[model samples]
Structure formats: structure tokens, C-alpha cells
Target: MKKSIIIAAIINCMAISSFAQEFGKHFADSTLRLDYIFGGKVSSDGKPECQVLLDGLVRTTGWSGRRNNLVSMPLAGNGRVTVRDKESGDTIYVTTFSTLFQEWLAMPESREVARSFENSFLVPMPRRLVTIDVELYDSNRKKVVEMSHNVNPSDILIVDRSNVNPNPHRYIHRSTHPERAIDVAILSEGYSVAEMDSFYKAAEIAVDAILSHEPFRSRADEFNFVAVGAPSSDSGVSVPRLGAWKSTAAGSNFSTFYSDRYLTTRNVKRVHDCLINVPYEHIIILANTTEYGGGGIYNFYTLTTAGHASFRPVVVHEFGHSFGGLA
Candidate 1:
């Protein structure tokens, strides 16, 4: 059994804000009075009670059916949010908000672990029995119902080498004229230009598939791509590995994987030798063949997805992360 990769396809709503809750406090830019009804892992019911406190947030008020994961209402309002049957759409036990209206705000300090942004809950290699669910209750109630919905980690999060954090002052040490003469180093431990050309051809095919969405048209300029030749063996030493393939969007900074990993975690002894060695922020790594898996990370590395698919997208996606204004 390989490590169970827990990826959170955490598509945080754009206008979200910091919220403080127990364990995982979620807050949106706007108050959400409505409870996400879960119906047997497929559908659920909603009773929009004009929960006054959540006026702008809650959509409507009404009664509901059976569901376990219910969002009790109005911190005392008589409304329930429940999950339904995956097939029948039958409600289980209705849920609502509890009377204890504990509102936790996100302070500037807790940005790193803020639950607002989707995170890859690293359940390292050799994954354990994984069973995930959601839950919430009314303000006046004291119980929570388990959501029927199941979320997959690989569907969202990526892992490269987000281990070493650069010094704050490093920003001051900028390259005299960054762009025209940026340090363009290729981290191909084993490929030649001709081989890389083939890899790029593979990458192009895959990347074109992802760009079909409308957003990619205007945001096209926000992307970059690179190719690596001989991949290194330091994967075990520098960062974590994936048991299976994974995927991520274009603007992610997962380019470091293609770079050589000499002393990744031991502090940027030689920033250049490590991932920080490059001038261009973004990077793309096209593994030569139909390998079994890949990984990605933020600021310090790269991610591997779509091994069975052509190499084009894998490289483009990595490049998207590396140069997508993440720095």
C-alpha cells in the first residue's frame, strides 16, 4: 500500500475572508447563512429561514427532510440544513446553527495555516485508510451531522518542496537587471536538447487541453514553461513523493521539481544549486515517458500530474505555477 495522498480540491471562493472557528474555522467575504445540505453523499434539503443575523447571506427560509450533516439555523432559528441520499435525494437529519455564535476572524499572523485557502492535508506516503466527511449545526443546537459528501485530496492539492523558506531580506538582493539576463538553468539530470524537444512536444499537447476554459484566454500572459532533461535521484531527500499521479492549475508555483535537489531542506546552502537558483520564477518539467506518478509544491518545487497523458501539459502546468506571480 502506498501513502494515501490527501489532496483538497479546495476551490476557495474568490471574495472569501478569514474566519475563526473550532479546529477549522471557515469565513467568507460575505456571511453565509445557508447550510450546505448533504443528501446521502449526493443531495440534501434546505430551509431558508430569514435568519436575521444572516440576512444578506442566507438565501431562503423553509423546512427540510432527513439528513445527517445539517446546518441548524439563525443561532437559534428553527431551520435545518441536511444532507440527502446520493441517489434518491432523500433528506436524513436536518441540521442548523448553534446558539453559540462564535465568530473567529483571521488575523494577519495566521495566514500560513488559514483554512480559507484550500490545503493539501499531507497524509504522507503509504496512505492510511482514508474516510473524509463534512459537518455543521445550528447556533442553538449542540450536535453536528456527518456530511455524506466525500472529497479526494489528489483532486486539489499539489506537493513539490515547500520546505525551506527564503529569508525576508532576500527580496532586497534582487538581480541587477532580472529579465534580460535572468539565470536560465535547466534541471534535466538526463536529457539532451533533442530529447527535450520531444518532451516539449508532449507538453504542448497536454497543456492545450487545459487552456480551453475561458479564463486561460486572458490570463495566458500569466504563464511560463520549462523542460528538464535528466531528472535527479534526490526526490527522497528533498521533498515528499506521490504514490499516484496528481494535478493542479496553471498559476501554481510547482516548478522546482525539475531542478536538482542537492541540499533542499538543509537551508539554502547554495540557493542556485537548490530550487531558488533560477532567475525565472516559473518552471515546467516534462518527465520523459509514461511514468507512474508525480508531485508538486509551492515556492520551493514542482508537481507531477497526467503521466499517462502527453508531457506537454505537465510541463506547462508546472511553468504556470513557477511564474504565476506567486512570489
Candidate 2:
């Protein structure tokens, strides 16, 4: 037993070392943002046809994602992003996700009209040229559509957003270095500049609520929480059913897809743009509303009401979907 245990330990250490070397050889310490448009419609044969298109590529400062899991995935999500070495055709990096577009396609609206949704993903900036493949899957876990393209690290056309000013933010819970921890950014959606302090307090409560649960409770030190104070001209989110609209930070709204309780934002690119100044792999937007509604999409984001009576539990539950990858 001791010999076997020793061998396992040695192998694990070697694998870690190998991944670290691979990361250094292939990637820089920056982030490469892949912007995509996911769209779908019914085909001539009455079959659902889905497609993915590369909207843009952005370069930003710092990479806070996992460097060890360079090619392995913990979850086989609804969609995938694969980055490969153009020269050797070897997969250097990969990530998976679930999208709002995938959910919208299941609804009746997709059949009635073709529509598209914005999605953006961040990968460690590559040091050399690479080919990227974006894919979407259906309910049966079959690939519906895929788009491929090459990216040159030295491309002059890639948008350089590294110098953009980030929203005001503060750390609610400080953990290990960003490279070794899960960084969660809690963004203020509808809070005005005067209400930022209240948002900070709510973010603190959110941190405590999340860490109070198991897995997170036992591994609390592996997480870091930052409260982003993105103020609004008017407080509270939009309620289209009541004709109540306000100028919120991320343009979040209730009644998504005509479902009153489904709260979400279509401005995914804007969300990523806001986090350029912070270290975030997962996002949790705290809208300053008393409405009892929230939404979460895997590898996307978590948005919930901060002033509702069930704030604590709702934030925890939504974080499970965003961070824990819970169904």
C-alpha cells in the first residue's frame, strides 16, 4: 500500500509539472477574448438548424483561469471552445459551457423566428498562432453546428481593451493568488453611486452565504470574492411587463422570453468588458431590486435580486449553478 501511494504521488506531481510547462510554452500572461454570435432557426426540412459565428477577438490584461486543466474538462457542457496549435494540430486549451441561446432554441420563439445571442469567452492568450473551434450541442448531446477560424497572436486587428478603465470594485473575501483560486465578481446592476455601500454590504452577506455551504465551506480558502460598484443613473432593473424600465449598469431586465421570473441580460459582451480590471472566472450580478427573480447559465453568469427577502438563499442557489455547475 505504501509503495502504491508513493507511486501515485510521484505521478501526480509529474503531471502537474508537465501542465505548468505546457502552459508556459504555449500561453502568455494575458487573456484572449473570443466573441461569438449563437443563432438558430428551423430549416427547409423542418429540422432545427443552429450556427456559431466569430464576432470578434479581444485582447485584455491578465489571465485568471485554470492553468493546470489545460485540456481536461470536469463537465461536458452544452457547448465547447477548443484552442489548438496551428502547426502541430494539438489541443492546447479547451473549455465548456451552457448558453442562453441553447435554452432559447428550446422555446417556441426560436421556431417562429430566427434569432441570435451574444456570447464571449476568455482564454489565456496564446504565444503563437492557433486555430479555434466553437461548437454547440442539442438536447441529445449531439453537435448541431461548429465554426472554425485561425488566430494570429500578432494580429493587429484584435481589439486591445487592456487599457480600458474597470468598474470600481472591492474584495469581500480575499483568498489565495488569483492563479490558484476561484475568483467571483459580484457586480452591482441597478445601484446608484449613492447606493454602492449598500451593495457592498449585500456582497459581504453573499460571500458568507456561499461559504456556509459544503464543498465551499470546506474549501473556502480556494475562493475570492470582489464587489464591483457599477452605479446606475436610476436604481432598480427594468420590468417590461409593468412598463417599468430604468437605466441599469448592464441593461438587465425581468420577463426574459416573456417569462416573468426569468431575469437575464443579452449584453454578454458588455459584462466581459466590465471585468477587464478585475480577476474573475465566474460572475454574479446583484441587481438592487426587491423582485424575487434570478438566473444562472453555466460558464456564463449569475444574476439575482439583492434586496429581496430571499436574497441570501437565492444568491447561494444561483452561485451553485454558476460556480458549482449544478443543474
Candidate 3:
């Protein structure tokens, strides 16, 4: 079995290399983030269908993904985004991701009414104008929705977030090159300005727990870590069940989806805005609460309570969903 697994990995590497040869011919070295609203409703046939709407584009510096797998995706997730050359319509870059919106569709609430959720994704910037196609798939791996739009690299409307916010951040681990490493940013959610020291201490504990894990421990040198000290007005997140609400940095709250232990935040755009000045491919938010609750969304963000007794294990498990992309 080990030999078979090794052979399969080798074949995948060769295929990625073959596809990467076309990267330079079509795309540049920067990154472009496409934000969208993913909505769904029951059709006339009584089956659910999804739709995608454009939410603004932002250009950021340094793409931290693998250059070899520019056009081929190793995982066929619930959603995919593809970039193609405008003239020839040849696919130049492709990536797959899962979303919380898809999961909500399966819940009992979705069956009673229509709903929408905010979603975002990143792609390698093309050198010239290109067509971006976003696709959503159902549980049976069938394509249910698709939308396409054109993007010009020199367009003035694209927001540039390379130097915004410029908040103070510390690097726990620094890789030699970002382009070849996995970049992760840890953001402070509920710690006040005076409690930054505590936030830093919690960030250290989180980093240690992640690095002590299996694959990460063996490949420590291939990752970079940054702690963004985003201060808040208060020191604890909101517990809606207790009618206790505090002004946190990222607007996090408990009682998500009507579950008291399921902590989450709907302000995704604000979370990204806080890290505008930092370079990251993944994000983890540390909330300053001793409650045993947290949430994670694949390819989106991870939120975990830092002051709980089971903090280490729970945070690591949530990271598996947000960063490792495991279900």
C-alpha cells in the first residue's frame, strides 16, 4: 500500500509540472482576490439550486500557492474557480474549495426558505484580460450553478490592499520564500489594546500546538506564521445565550445557527480588512474567552476560543478543517 501511494504521488507531480509550463505564458506573479455572494433557493421542481454574484475584486502582493499546479486541481471540491485566456479560451489557472454556504443548504432551515452567504476566493493574476468562471456543485458532484466575468489587469476599479491598515504584527516563523511556503496569519479578535501581551502569549501557544502536530512538525521549514495584534474595545466575545455582548474586534459571537457552543462571526469582510497589510494564504482568529466553543470554514477562516482548558486540541482540530481542508 505504501508503494502504491508513493507511485500515485509521483504521477501527480509529473502532471502538475506539465501544466505549470503554461503559467508564465498566461499569468503574472501577483494575486487577485474575488469576493462573491453565494445564494440558493428551491426551484420549481422542488430541488435546490445555487447562484453566484460578483462582490468586488482586490489585488494583493505575492501569490503564496504552488506554481506547479497552476491549471490542475488535485481535489474536486464543492466549488471551483477557473481563469482562462480571453482570446483562445484556454484554461490557465484552476482551484477547488468548499464553503459554509453549501453546508447550510443541507440543514433544515434551507428547506423552508431561500438564503445567501458571503464567499471569497483567490487566484493568480493574469497578465492580460481573462475570463473568470465560478462553479458550484451539488452533493452528487453535479454542477448546479456557474457564472463568468471578465477582468482586465490594468483596470482602475480593482482595490489594492497591499499596503492598507499596516497594523503591528509579529512573525513566529519566517520561511525563506513566501512563493514556495504556506503562509498563515493569526488575528486577535477580542483582546483589548491593554491586553496585547496576553494575545501574544495565546498566539504563541496556538503556534506551538500546530507545529507539534504530525505533518507540520516534519515540514516546519515550509511554513510561515504571523500574529496580527488587532486590538479591541473589550476583552471577551459575545455570549448571546446569556444576553452578554461585548464590543470585540472581529464582531464574534456565540449561539451561531442557534447552537450555544458554536461560535462564529458573519463579518468576514472586516476580518480580511484587518489583515489587508499582511501577506497570508490562510487565517486563524483567536477569541479571548474561556468558553469551549469555536468554528472553522474550509478555505475561509478558523475561529477558536483561547482561554479554554481544551484550547490546544480544539484549535488544532479546527485548523484541520480551515487549513488542512478536511471535513
Candidate 4:
């Protein structure tokens, strides 16, 4: 029995060593950001067709995502991003996500006009050339459209934002290491520079709310929460229905798709730009408003009004959509 146990331990160690070596062989201790335009329109036959285009590649410091599961996804989300070695044609990494564009395609507006939405995703930086394929899937798991591109690590055009993000930030909770924990960044959306203290307090409340839940409560130490203070010039978010527009940090607004209280931000790239200096795997934007509304997209972001009477539960519910991938 002892001999068998010793042999099993040896095998596990060997597997760990192999995984590390394989990861180090292809990736660096950095991040590669892929920016894309996802668009679609109704065809003459009334069938909706969509396509994705490469916008740009960005390089940032640190890879705060998973070290294991480099070649697989736990959930087959609405879309997939696959990274493969250029020379070997071997898939080295894979991830799945859902986007606002996918949700917009179901709207009547898409049939009347062609529209595009900006999206951004992060992968571990590759040391060599790699081919990346971004694919969208239908409800039946059939491929809808795909865009493929090659990325070179030495490309001069890749924007380098390796410098520390200059925005003011505070850690509500922390983990010993980034890769071992789920990092969540709460960004101040409509709050002005003077209201950052309030934002921090709200972020702390959000952390407490999240930790009060079951699985998260048990695994609380495996989470890190940071509040990024990206102040707005205006003190509140826009309400198009009221003709009240504010120049907020994220360009977020209520009445998304003409639905009052449905708040969202189409400036996805800017949402990511705020976190270039912060380590985050998930995002939560706190709009400084007393309005009672919020929005969430799977693997994208959770945006909720911070001053609402139901702020605590609303934030928790939206997080279930963004982080928990709940319906």
C-alpha cells in the first residue's frame, strides 16, 4: 500500500512539472489583449448574419488568470477564443465568453441596420508567433462566424501598456497570489473625483455582500477585491429618457435598447482600458446613482447603481450573472 501511494505521488509531481514546463515553453509572465469588432445584420432573406474583425493587439503586465486548464474550457460559452502555435499548429490555450453583441443580435434594431460593437479579451502573452481564432456559436452550438489572425510577440504595432495603471485604487480583500485567486475590480463609473471615498465604502459593502453568499463565503480567501477610482467629470450617469446626459468615465447610460432602467456601457474597450494597470479577471462598475437598475453580461461586466436602496442585493444578483454565469 505504501509503495503504491509513493508511486502515485511521484506521478502527480511529474504531471505538475510537465504542465509547468509546457506553460513556460510557450508563454511569458505578461498578458496579450485582443481587441475586436463584432457586428451583424439581417440578410435579404431575413436571416441574421454576423462577423468579427480584428481591431488591435495590446500587451500588458502580468497574467492573473489560470495556470492550469490551458487547453480547455469548463463551460462552452456562446463564443470561444483559441490560441495555437503558428509553427506547430497546436492549440496551446482556449477560453470561452459571451458578449453584448450576441445579445443585441436578437433585437429588432439588428434587422433594420448593420451595427458593430467593440470587445476586448486577455490571454497569457506568447513568446513566439501564434494564431488566434475567435468563433461565435448559435444556441445549438453550431458555429455562426469566426475570425482568425496571427500575432507576433515582436510586433511593433502592439500597444505596450506595461506601466502601472495610474488610477487610484484600494484593496477591499486580498489573496496571497493573483493566479491562485479570482480577482475582481470594482470601478467607479459616474462618481466624481470628490466622491471616491463613498465609492470605496460602497465597494466594501459589495465585498461583504458577495462573501455572504454560500460558495464564496466558504472560499472567501480565494478571492481578491480591488476598487478602482476612475472618477467622472459629472456626478451621475446619463438618463437618455430624461434627456439628462453626463460625461461619465465609462460612457454608461440608462435606457439601453430603449428599455428604461436597463443600464449598460457600450464602451467595452474603455472599460478594459481602466484595468490595464490593475489585476482583474472580473469587473463590476458601480454607477453613482440612486436609480434602481443594473446590467450584467456573462464574462463581461456587472454594472449596478451604488446608491439604490436595493444596492446590496442588486449587486449580488448582477454578479451571479457576470461571475456566476447565471441566467
Model 1 CA RMSD to the hidden true structure, in angstroms: 20.5
Give all TM-scores, in the order shown.
0.27, 0.92, 0.89, 0.92
Ranking by TM-score: 2, 4, 3, 1
Worst 10 residues of 3 by lDDT: 10-19
Predictions: Cα RMSD each:
20.5, 5.0, 3.6, 6.2
For model 1, how does the per-residue alpha-carbon lDDT over 205-310 read when each residue is reduced to its tens digit? Answer: 5446434433443333333333323323322111223332222112222223233221111111122223221223223333432443343233223434333553
lDDT-superior candidate, 1 or 2:
2
The TM-score of candidate 2 is 0.92
Q: Which scores better on TM-score, 3 or 4?
A: 4
lDDT to native, each model:
0.27, 0.84, 0.80, 0.84
lDDT per residue for candidate 3 within 58-127, as digits (tens), equals 8887666557766776456788999998988988888788887887777777777888877778787889
Judged by lDDT against the true structure, how good is candidate 4? Answer: 0.84
Candidates sorted by lDDT, best first: 4, 2, 3, 1
Clashing residue pairs in candidate 2 (N, C-alpha, C atoms within 3 angstroms) = none
lDDT, candidate 3, residue 43?
A: 62
RMSD of 3: 3.6
Can you list the residue pairs that collide in candidate 3?
none
lDDT (tens digit, per residue) of candidate 2 on 178-218: 44766789999999999989999999988999888665665
